[model samples]
Target: MATMEWIAACREELYALREELHRCPELSHQEYRTSALIEKQLRAWGIPVLDFHLETGVVAKISGGHSGKLLVLREDIDALPIQENTGLPFSSQVSGVCHACGHDIHTTALLGAARLLSEHRDQLHGDVLLVFQCAEESFDGAASMLAHGIFSAQTPNAVVGFHCAPQLQVGKVEISAGIREASCDSLTLTVVGKGGHGAHPDECIDPVVMSAGLLMQLQTLVSRRNKATDPVVLTFGEIHGGSAPNVIPDQVLLRGTLRTFDNRVRMAHLAALEDLCTGFCRALGGTCTVTVEKSLPPLINSPDICQQLLTSAQTVLGEDCLGSESAPSMGSDDFSCMLEACGNHGAQYLVGTGLENDPATRMGLHVAENIFPSQAIEPAAATLVQFALDYLN
Candidate 1:
């Protein structure tokens, strides 16, 4: 079979595999069964599963017919923490967790590409690296896999990954050349101060008072400092301080998330935030600590690579089906972290799985009712395989 025909022939098995993944969705960093299934599937096809020191996910390699540049195709194999309410027969068997982000499709599509690539190795000039990475929802999978040396032995010349886009209809995909995804920094700010009676005005440093002021000023980093055109989001989802209403707590914990589109702006804002927090707290006779758990870097698509994928997508979906040009999103994918490992020569695309008439299928990712139509699998898989052939050949 030709490059695209391979996926069409294997659609039935691809559907079954995706459903199998959807039914037993696994959470980030806990994808033992998912990883095992991937390992079994890849090994069954004579592909070599690399001996990496990863706790979850599988990394396999497909050697081309000859020596050339390496290409890495990654797929996230983890689910979200949401409960399944899609009402499908293959609804998530695991309660309180589901593959609402369409990772089932992502994993299965990549698997389909593996099957096609395995058959069409003669068309490729270089090896293809398959990264079924884990812990994407936690935003630490790519970084953790790097720490474990997933790419230490075999670094690719370019990388590619895909995510489901609920807004676009099935058979369509979106790709851009620059800043496709944002940088995320999960932050925990601890406001430390003297504990005393709430009634005490002078003796108690009052962390509650300090936290309130800090939260208000944190907004200024985006509004007062950064360029208005470049978007930034700083949101706090949790705040815990005192147990008693009459007592002033010694410490207040503020947990928030920061998102930026540019890495240069991201770094500057991070430093500015720490300085602002420290100075603001000390000026009020208190100390504040900002513990930033960095998640993902800005996802930048290589211009040359995007041009190649555009041709690949055109072959599968036609030119009219290509999405209209749009600006990049503030969303972050852990795949961005792996881009740095590959010398920043990669791009991740948004594969549209939404149906125009089916509201449930069109629901945004991470929502309990979000589900993808099975029709999305074959074409998505074919596009990826074609991109590999186009770039490497």
Candidate 2:
């Protein structure tokens, strides 16, 4: 039987697994139950599981009848900390946690590929490494796995992964070469000042004022420092200061992320941010400190490999469903770490999950109410399976 034939045979099972996963979402590094369930399913499919001894996550292997190349198929399995509002029959059972990022779809697609590919082992020319990873929500799962020697024994010839796009219709697939996603730097800036009664405006240093001024300065840094063609985003999502209406807080905390398409610009922006905050605050009788705690590099895809997958995906979704020149996204993914290991031999693309004319299904990812039709799974899985077969054969 062909790959799709095998995939079709297992479609119902895949849907059940997806719902099972959706009903019980787990947070990053806390996917013990998720990992166990994944391991159980892989074992039942007669695939060999590798003992990575990971606290959470699963790694399994499917060897070809003849060996020629090694390809890695990776998926992230962690959920976001968002309350469920879709009210699907299989809403997240966990409180304050849901698979709002479509990781549930990614995981299910990879597992479907695993099952169908295992059935086609005799026809395969290379092995497939199935990586169901955890902690992707924090953008360090791939790095953490690499640190623990996930690729120590042998590096793969190529790695492939996909993220669900809620904005695109379900039958379409998009791939782009070069920089496909932005790099992310988590920024935390603290403005410190002397606290005083609100009534006495002259006595207090007024860090709230300092923080607001510095945020505007940060925006100017992005606009003036970077080229107009190069995109940069500096967002301060959370601002916290002052406890009461009558008293001024000693300090204010501002947390945000810096996303940039260029590496040099990212570095320059970081330096400028520190200088701007320190200089701007001290001049106003306050002090500020900026901390960049975590960073994820831009997702760069291989042109040649992207073309190969474009053809492969066209076989699954008709030729008209393939797109290769779409604008790159600013969202970040940890899969770029794996691409860094394999050089330009890997690519990650977008799999459309949106339904036409359905406002409810068009909500952006990471939103609590974000949802997609189940019909989107077949094309994604079939495309993955076909790509693996084409490359390996």
What are the TM-scores, per candidate, against the unseen true structure? Answer: 0.97, 0.91
lDDT at 374 for candidate 2? 72
By summed lDDT, the worst window of 10 consecutive residues in model 2 runs over 1-10
Which runs in model 1 stand beyond 4 Å of their true positions?
A: none
All candidates: CA RMSD (Å): 1.3, 2.3
Best TM-score among the predictions, by candidate number = 1
Off by over 4 Å in 2: 198-204, 323-325, 357-359
Cα deviation in Å at residue 306, candidate 1? 0.9
Q: How many pairs collide in each candidate, listed in order?
A: 0, 0
Per-residue CA lDDT of model 1 for 1-393, tens digit only, reads 565577778888999998899999999999999999999998898889998778998998889998899899999999998999989999999989899888989999999899779877876799999999999999998899889888887678999988888888898888889888789999999999999988885879999999999999999999999999888998999999999998998999999989998878889899999999999999999999999996688888999888889989888778865776567878788899989899999898888888888998887988998878888887688788989988888
- Quote model 1's TM-score: 0.97
Q: After superposition, how far is residue 5 of candidate 1 from its true place, in Å?
A: 2.2
lDDT of 2 by residue, 264-370 (tens): 88898889899999999999999999999768878899988889998898777778977446778798888888888776589998888888778768898899998
